[model samples]
Target chain A: MRHISHTDINYADLFADFRDPNSGAVVMFSGEVRDNNKGKAVTHLEYEAYEPMAEKMIDEILNAALEKWPLNKAICVHRVGPIDVCGCAVVVITSSAHRAAAYEANRYIIDRVKYEAPIWKHEFFTDGTSEWGQNCDCSSPSHPHHHEHKHHHAE
Target chain B: METTIQVTCFAGLRKFFNCPLTINLKLPTAYEDVLLEMKKVNPEASEILDSCRIAVCESFVPRTALMTSDEPLFIIPPSSGG
Candidate 1:
């Protein structure tokens, strides 16, 4: 299961669908919005995505993980739009026959989704300034030095 | 026939472009052309996009990748999602 949701993520609803009697292990991961970033106090976070592309890319990430692991179920949910600090932003859940596969696959899905998905973040800082978070780990050859946010001032 | 790529902007770019956006290209276009065009519309976003990545058809493409006008182009600024 994969979705780009605008409403708050319902963890229980997702976990319910993740049940698989054949699987012995289930792993779940949730990422929340924090109140600070790089030493700057944040007011809130606004998330946006190329909705159609974001959903499609998320499926690709899940398919890649399914190929590497013997999994019974895989579910990923990403929330878009304004989220208050400490609100859940994303979740990854995987169920497999063994703990090792479940854990590993869960980690892989989340990491790949973070870098591959067409999702973008706009951080509102307490200083009344906002900036787009750079795609530092997008894993694209075109972004070899994306690790740093390069800014050019208008003359 | 002319091709108009659906260019979706997110986050800061969304605010800048008032997204649900599209760009027209003359048949053959490359990734950099999109960037150049975006810079012309909003110079401030050029710097922000410099730190961003561009994805076509849900995959990140290199600057040199050639795209036709029908393909969907997404200008992805650095992602903060987990």
Candidate 2:
């Protein structure tokens, strides 16, 4: 499956594909757009992606996860364009014979995709002002400066 | 002869430059040369350019990496997609 989507993501349709009889565990993660960020009242978000590169990078992340973990299936879908508050922005699913591999691989894929994918988010606020969303502050050691100067989100 | 590299900008760089930009440089141009040319066109973009990463042929390349004309370049600012 392709990594990026321009329309709203249907979680049910995505989850239906993971019906592997041999797989004992399926882990899914959905990153939704919240109504607030950094103390600002966010109205919505517009996501843009360098489509070709973003697809390639997400594919690489999924492939690497499959190689690192014994999995039955792995898939990720990220939405672009305008997304309303509470809208699903991205989703990652991994199925394996055990829960540990499924859980670990799901986390790895989401984290890597967030840092490595060439997708940008533009945030619109209630005060009639907007700004480009800062990239995540948790920088990978390999590309420590990639997210330089961005504010860290306290999870 | 001069070589033209078409650069696709994203996020803040796109909004700053208004659109994708093309820069003409001598052959065997390094990634930094493109940024330099961009700075010449839009001096105000220098700060944003400094923090940007250049991607060639779908992969991020170091500033010193040589660029070819056929491969469309991408100027990626900090990405915030989750």
Q: Candidate 2, clashing residue pairs?
A: none
Q: Is the docking of candidate 2 incorrect, acceptable, medium or high quality?
A: medium
lDDT of 1 by residue, A7-43 (tens): 9998878888877788889899998888999899999
RMSD of each: 5.0, 4.4
Compose the digit string of candidate 2's lDDT tens values, residues B1-82: 7877788888888756756677788888788888898999888888778777788878888888777665778888867778
- Against the native complex, each candidate's DockQ, computed on alpha carbons, is 0.47, 0.54
Query: Where's the lowest-lDDT run of ten residues in candidate 2 chain B?
Result: B14-23
Q: All candidates' lDDT scores?
A: 0.77, 0.84
